[model samples]
Target: MKLLLTLCFTCALLITAESLNCHVCANQNCSTSTSVACPAFSVCSTVTLLRRSGTSTTVTVNKNCSTLPSCPSLLGSETEWSVNQGFAREARRQLCCITNDCNMRTLAVPNSVINGRQCPGCASSAESLNGSCNATVSCEGVEDRCFNSTTLNSTQLMIRGCISNNLCVLQAIFGDLLSGSIDITCGAPCSYRMSTLLLTFAVAAHKVLL
Candidate 1:
């Protein structure tokens, strides 16, 4: 019984060692005998398994290894990626205006001049018809004028614009990384990378709100 137990322990240790050993293949095409291995970035084609009989034997086999889809390769876990993407998408949506009324506008007359002033004719053809005003009566260049007629408030517009601009800038900087423009580097662990990016985003957002 003692001898049998020893044999079983030895066999278990050998199996554990074999399982722990990671033999990365060099060539895209690899066999059990080929010692060369592919780099970390390259796709793995097959994994070699060793069988211990009277003598150790190498077993060559093909494996169905799937590659990760191309996306912004931000260093983070899946949850981090999801949160960042959600924030970015929301910011973009807030920034973009589908209707003509709520869109951002540049004003010829500053907010200081138009505040608390009720000049209906200020935006009427009557002003153009009169000799007093030579310019067209349109709300084209004025942000305050645009919002004055819309359901949104000045503060809301400002916040939306700020958030959207920040999101766009970040997206532009990390677009390639997110869109899988670069291959995944093993050195930048996903969790660490995500924390750093999220921290930067949060800081920027806080500053903007302040």
Candidate 2:
């Protein structure tokens, strides 16, 4: 009977070894966290999110277990979006690893610097729902693409902004954690004017030479 009890205890430890363990926290500093075992093929992830409206910026952090296949490549990467030039913005950074309790790091949002591309901008509010987005904003940093996003929840909130090329990929993987279940549609490249003008100038010079 004692031998059977010992074997049962060994089996339990073996089962626990097969699962990944990760720290879970949802505070700005991640000062306190709890370790929990994750499901099969899971990885430990730590994410930081920043939301800005005008001069007010709010930062939040969450660390937990994730099953995203792209987690490995997404480590230490950040994405950003903005509306009204710099009036409203959002940024997220993620760190993911496959080893048990490996996501012990924390991330913070980076500052924004304008990159000169322009896009129509509007914040999510009653006025924006009417499609009266005549205002434009200078795109910032790696945010060379324009985007229109609407939440899938009952509120159906809408926002138009500038974003990085990988923002969409992160949104697809992170879902509600990034911005809720958002339906995002990206617009055409916003920095085409300079190229178009250069092409026109080259053509004119060729005609003159002929």
Candidate 3:
């Protein structure tokens, strides 16, 4: 009887260990998030992104369960870009926590200050391929490396921006673990555009790395 009781106790511990709870929300307001059990091997994730296009700016926050354990390697990374002065320019940070509902707190967006580096910035889609940009963005903060990435999923999207060296390397190392594959190429000298150089890619907030 004692052996049977021990087996039952072990089973209970296993059950508890298999379940993880995390807060889930997609809105900027994460204060009213719902708690739900995540799948086995999943952890809580909080992602904050700030995007700017022309004169418009938006901040977005998301919390959910994630299975990618390597995502935390990008904890404080930021990207900057401008496309013809009116395309989607973004700065993003991600956080991963192992405790239940640990992602309830929202992360702040990182600020963009001219870091004296520059990169070619552009975006394209299958429907409307711009192919190139005449203007280049002066990179900000730790965005010392230039990158070009193409989405391999159904979206058919391509992005070019300035990224930190660590972010670029981590993305390459963990590219296989992400949801969808992205072909990323980094490095290359960014020359100024004599006619169309713009400061449109400046970030909205200060250095708020996760």
Candidate 4:
């Protein structure tokens, strides 16, 4: 009887050890779903990014286990994380939960509202994409920002577009993570037509990497 009790106790411990699980996916099909045992003391998270330019919009979602601290949304009760990348003319939202399989639900993407703001817009990479801005774009929703992003010892990336006002508040929450290599500066509407000169980021890096 003693041996049997010991075996049963061991089995219970094993089950407890394997209880934590989370879903994992990366910018893949919205219908696709899978789950795996989460690492010890980890929480399930979901990161959703929405990119819009011209008249087109795209959605990207990523779900997985994260050890990062839970980010509570201050803007609203349901929305946990949101950012308007004025530089790249993109927007993002995130949700984080601790309950098992809590991240399985789909999140609603907010609609863009034109706020009469404008800024330069363009995209460039080492590879030939030839992204350019013919003119400034009208800002909508929370997109009332002008942003600049520069990489260190690498290609220069610029995003001039409308961004949400909440983005500035969110940036403060991340003060613990910013580094010299990566800098994001955001402000108000820019000139009607603005463009950035492609240069070795080694020089621009000096401006932000203080």
Best by lDDT: 2
Better of 2 and 4 by lDDT: 2
Full ranking by TM-score: 2, 3, 4, 1
Write one digit per residue (lDDT tens) for candidate 3, span 1-210: 999967855654454357789999844566568889998767678777666765688877878988544454432232322222125455656676667887777776756666666776653332224445444667765566777776677765556667666556566432442335777787665554333334332232233331
Question: Which regions of candidate 2 fall more than 4 Å away from where they truly are?
Answer: 1-17, 26-28, 69-87, 149-158, 169-183, 192-210
Candidate 1 local distance difference test against the native: 0.24
| Per-residue alpha-carbon lDDT of candidate 2 for residues 1-210, written as tens digits (9 for 90 to 100) | 999967854654454346888999845567778888897656678877677776787888888987555452433344343333235676666677666787777665654677768877764445456655556767765677887777777666556767776665556643443446877787468853356778899999999999
For 1-210, candidate 4 gives per-residue lDDT tens digits of 999967855653454354567788733665566787787656567666676544567777777776534443521134522333333335546666556776666666655665555755443222112334334556655565665544342544443344465555555442222222445577655444233543446558877897
Per-candidate RMSD, Å: 28.2, 9.5, 12.2, 14.5
Tens-place lDDT per residue, model 1, 1-210, is 999967855653343332121233334434222223332322222222222222333333323221222212221111111101111111011111111122122112111111221111122223322423322211111111111111122221111101112223233322332332221111111211135778899999999999
lDDT agreement with native, every candidate: 0.24, 0.65, 0.60, 0.53
Instruction: Report clashes for each candidate as comma-separated counts.
Output: 16, 0, 2, 7
Could you tell me the TM-score of candidate 2?
0.64
- CA lDDT of 149 in candidate 1? 14
* Of candidates 4 and 2, the better by TM-score: 2
Model 1 spans with C-alpha error above 4 angstroms: 1-77, 82-173, 177-210
Checking candidate 4 for backbone clashes, the offending pairs are 87-159, 113-140, 113-141, 114-140, 142-164, 143-162, 143-163
Assess candidate 2 and give its lDDT: 0.65
Please report how far candidate 3 places residue 63 from its true position, in Å.
1.2
